[model samples]
Target: MDRQLAERLEIFERTGQVAPEICRFVRTELDVLDAAGSEITEESAGTLTSHLLLALQRSRDGGALTEFAADETVRAELAGHPDALEQAAALAERAESALDVVLPGQEVRFLALHLALLRQREAMR
Candidate 1:
């Protein structure tokens, strides 16, 4: 396991809590992903986009989404909007690519898992 992920898991094990904002984001994203198992209408797409924007904001501010975490809803929305998908894919790919620089190879599996989840989410689209 990645050290960072391991540490995070430990922290959760010990504290039984994550940042409130992160928890909210994760729950919302996961619910959206679960909802993706059905049709992704325009209204759903708008909701997904709103959540992604929120996730992006959190990420930009150095907050982690380890608690709730983003899911496949992002990809589903992208499928609905090709242009937006392209933009989001680019941004996500960039983030994935930069993981090594960001973490210096410590617990890299955690990063891979994150990217994999994002890919799974995208695949839903």
Candidate 2:
């Protein structure tokens, strides 16, 4: 397994948890982003997977962090591409169902921020 993935698996095992299958869902999202022409890198995948797993754990632990007010920087970064936001929302929704917790807008926006950062990285490539 990839180093980051192995570390993630360790986190699950150490916590008395299984792989949760949500990783597959995240992989699908990454695939979708790639299909849409985003040049997602290995580093980005590792970062995103780690983040998503943590977010899922947070949801299960009843922590949504905070509420999100609209941010133009995020909007400006993702302008003309609502799909990025949608993708994040989809992941959050999936996490909610799998973890059985309510996720706030902040979590969704955090996911979108990750997507936006990936896109920015792609542009730099």
Candidate 3:
């Protein structure tokens, strides 16, 4: 296991309330971010991890956030960054498979935004 993942798992285990599956899901996303060299800030990681875990829990509970529709403004903005859009779509596909839930385009756009923001942060650094 990656050191980061091991450390994260340790923390999750200490929480005593996290399900093993949730930890696996979080670890998967963290691994993906690490593999892509995306270094999100600790705050971002905490927020993203919480959201991802909640999403997975909802999926498992048969109550996915299915009503979040992407507006044209979001689509238009994402169109400006074709690469980010494409990468996000691909990542969303993997996330769907991993979570066994079909995320709405808005959720996928959120993922793109996350990646774009992370990349922008890296560029700023």
What is the Cα-based lDDT of residue 17 in candidate 1?
A: 47
Which prediction has more favorable lDDT, 2 or 3? 2
lDDT of 3: 0.64
In terms of lDDT, the best-performing candidate is 2
Per-residue lDDT of candidate 3, residues 1-125 (tens digit): 34553665657656854567667766776777767777644544555555555555566666766665555667787766677767767866776776666656666676666666666776776
Kindly list the per-residue Cα lDDT of model 1 for residues 1-125, writing each as its tens digit.
22443344345335644344443343344445446463333332333333443444445456636442344554443444554344345445544454311221211222334334455555777
Q: Write down the TM-score of every candidate.
A: 0.27, 0.62, 0.67
Candidate 1 residue pairs that clash: 2-107, 26-68, 26-69, 72-121
Q: Report the alpha-carbon TM-score of model 3 versus the true structure.
A: 0.67
Summed over model 1, clashes come to 4
Candidate 2 collision pairs = none
Q: Say which prediction, candidate 2 or candidate 3, comes out ahead on TM-score.
A: 3
Candidates by TM-score, descending order: 3, 2, 1
Q: Please identify model 2 stretches exceeding 4 Å from their true place.
A: 1-42, 67-81, 97-99
Prediction 1 TM-score vs. true: 0.27
For model 2, the run of ten residues with the poorest summed lDDT: 17-26
Using lDDT, rank the candidates from best to worst: 2, 3, 1
